[model samples]
Target chain A: MTGGRGSGLARLSLNQKTTNRWSVAEAVQGCVRAGLPAIGLWREPVHEIGVLAAVQLVTDAGLRVSSLCRGGFLTDPTATGRQAALDDNRRAIDEAAALGTDCLVMVVGGLPTGSRDLPGARHSVVDGIAALVPYARERRVRLALEPMHPIFCADRGVLSTLSQALDIAECFAADEVGVVVDTFHVWWDPEVMTQIARATGRIASFQVCDWITPLPPDALLSRGIMGDGHIDFRGLRRAVEAANYLGDVEVEIFNADVWDADPDEVVATVTQRYLDVVLDG
Target chain B: MTGGRGSGLARLSLNQKTTNRWSVAEAVQGCVRAGLPAIGLWREPVHEIGVLAAVQLVTDAGLRVSSLCRGGFLTDPTATGRQAALDDNRRAIDEAAALGTDCLVMVVGGLPTGSRDLPGARHSVVDGIAALVPYARERRVRLALEPMHPIFCADRGVLSTLSQALDIAECFAADEVGVVVDTFHVWWDPEVMTQIARATGRIASFQVCDWITPLPPDALLSRGIMGDGHIDFRGLRRAVEAANYLGDVEVEIFNADVWDADPDEVVATVTQRYLDVVLDG
Candidate 1:
């Protein structure tokens, strides 16, 4: 039931979080079984199976690694805390390099514990990314700045707009620092289309997911599968394509319902929806 | 203990939603009892007593009508839907004028019923506002465009940033169209300070609330009382003031806990927190 299944499937990639219950090997196997060309890997599971072994498994399965889950929580307020975060981000860069994916998604962190200095925290994120750029550049791992939805600004990521992310990323070379165009996080931005145009060569990864309402108690798991929410998928996909992003179009959903469902069925639904709503109108 | 009680109380206006249990008479009485100089009225409660009587209630209490709750849900796809919304907004303009307030907070509606046309919906909002401007201008009511957090863009406000709101408001005279700087919605925005500075004469109403996490099941009730969450109140307050907004500072919280509390207790807490966090810093 892969509805519009032609060149679209070649562009399709399954993000690991969409099938949260699956192990790294299982996700890779699921991608292969569903005829997916690539798989977006998460840090925790890759660490569990060991990055080297995970890399070997994906390579043997002929699956390209679209991206490494995340590598930035650089908003810690203390000098020691920031130093430690930099050390961790360096390790993440090494992992992203090992995974054979140039894109290392950066979820720049929010305010420190009880502090409300949003501007100061944002400055810390920029400073932290600046510290990581040289290392990422040396490793050939492009740091993909993921500007999360404003809902996560206080606790998850203070970087709230694509324009804001570009302001930071543009400070470095496009290949060294790029932006992640995750539809779920950015579909609501009035400037999103224009920003996508502005991203041009700086789009490290273009991920798709839907924005559903009556958000779950845990707002972090609020993402819906494509076509299930109010986002105009084809519109965004065309904009990303126009931005010259010829990379894998990753399907990254974070809904509890999808997590609870069987992974195989979820992959099938994703593939069908990707074709029906994303690649085609 | 009215904490830091002098000049600050003069500037404090309690939004009616903060005391959801109160009637127009009760809210007005509560403001005077707390020595607060104003009350931000909501249309429902005002309509509950008839707009004229609600006006009399506040006027006799020597309370200023800081601003009207709302007057724009203009994203309906059909012409009739939009025309009806425009007509309703006209009544709202008349109400605001009768109530003797110049500011009418406009929460431009979300995506149409099941449509994913975000750009289309946003264009409708702009058209809707454009349609209302003449009437609002005649009635001396400023359409305070509220750029809600992106979380609400799909259902509450398509306008998601102070910059976007200003972009739309700048199309008309500053008095006819303006923006609402609600701390709960704009606190997380990286460009808030700069946008607030840009809002200069267009800062229609400055509303205060805290952004509490572990959001309640209903995201609409996610707002916290001042100092209960992560907003830098004094900073936003100073920014609004610097923008030459010489108006009442309204405290509008929709948290269930705040709504469930005794209205008097809530008013006292708001006054105290306003003095401690927003004014004194």
Candidate 2:
């Protein structure tokens, strides 16, 4: 609010999961107190506050809801599992609509238990997303298909590359479905630059999380603060910008160290690092 | 070699690393006693026995040398580091030639210390391979480019996809440069089917290992015996076979549990599992 030029904070958004301990109101206040213009919301915190009130909270705070955390586990092998996933995603779409966010990120569930049918699991994801398309389109919410790292293909997601996510999203129009460009999941891809360029109008969300090595036993928590890891944030940010993706660059660190830090300090450190590595560096 | 019609063991090759306890002589004896005709050799063990003697041990035992486990660490950022890796790789090539194996598998190296330049590291690998091509061709050995899984891209191999390997390998004759189709490294790729189809005569080796979940702290030892994890061994094997890859199926598990087991029992379990899941399944 100082210069109104919005240079540094203009496209910056704090994804809620970055601060594991912060409640919805706390994260909102943390963003406001840190002078950020937007915040990404996770479903758990939004549900705790009630969807309508969650909407009112950010509205009163002069904050934008950059994206809703997630809306897919669509790759189950059984009919019951598939039906349940579709039903849950419909509710997620409603929540995103109520929260005034156009993007609902989908992590697309991995293989069904005890199953090695990777292709079948991938098909189920496509089918499940297709089932939710009408609902998401009607609500004006974009179903953002996020390709998790290949390591998660067996347990967390079947979509493991931007090309694969684009393959699924192509089944629907851009508004009904799109792809998320998360730096953590995709920075290792050889074709990432070309894929990011091809993403163009289809990039639903752009989340930043650097990859740190000597990965902990739990690979999920290997993501670190921007400047603390190996990701080329400047190159990737420039690629996304060239793709014409004008969206929030949500800082989404998942390291245990950052989670254990104070929310205020976490935001301050991350914001400065983001400006240094992603925006100005 | 009782029934010389190429018994049940004709196509099996036990990679030396699979049984960490087995010396070159021990592994050759174990393979012969278990009815296998071929054995894959690693450089460290070959060096331990003196490369010339390692070759004689397998030869006197009537076992064929399937491949030399590796000859690459070519991604170092510094000139001294690069030179050291090249020197080591050159020695490995000589050992492979002395052992009469036509294929030398290359794990290639990961990013250099404190360097996040993945592209630069990959370029180094390609350049390193090209440099070794003349020497490899003279020895009648093919430099087998093995694209490791993306998870290993940070610390193991920078070539993380078959197409990337083929792109480099295509720059030379098939006999001078080729690829290793390792099940554990590529079973997750969505483009794997097409890439394998495109590999054709370029597949110099076919290594089999399953990927077990909840990877241990040292992810390098995460591989398990066939049928013990999520890989479609038969499917991948068929793809390689269809691509005209007439080579030994080297069982190359690297788990701590496997390493702790008796070498003979380890060989038996892995062979039977390979037959069940990869050959007859």
| Best model number under TM-score | 1
The C-alpha lDDT values of all candidates are: 0.91, 0.88
Query: Candidate 2 on A17-107: residue-level lDDT in tens?
Result: 9998999999999999999899999999888989988888899999999999888988777788878888899999999999899999998
Model 1 steric clash pairs: none
DockQ values for all predictions? 0.82, 0.70
True contacts kept of 2: 0.60
Candidate 1: tens digits of C-alpha lDDT, residues B143-260: 9999998889888889989999999999999999999999988988878889999999999999999988766668888899888889999999899999998789999999888888
Residue ranges of candidate 1 with Cα displaced over 4 Å: A1-6, B1-4
Off by over 4 Å in 2: A1-6, B1-6
Candidate 2 residue A238 Cα shift, in angstroms, is 0.4
Error of 1 at B240 (Å): 1.0
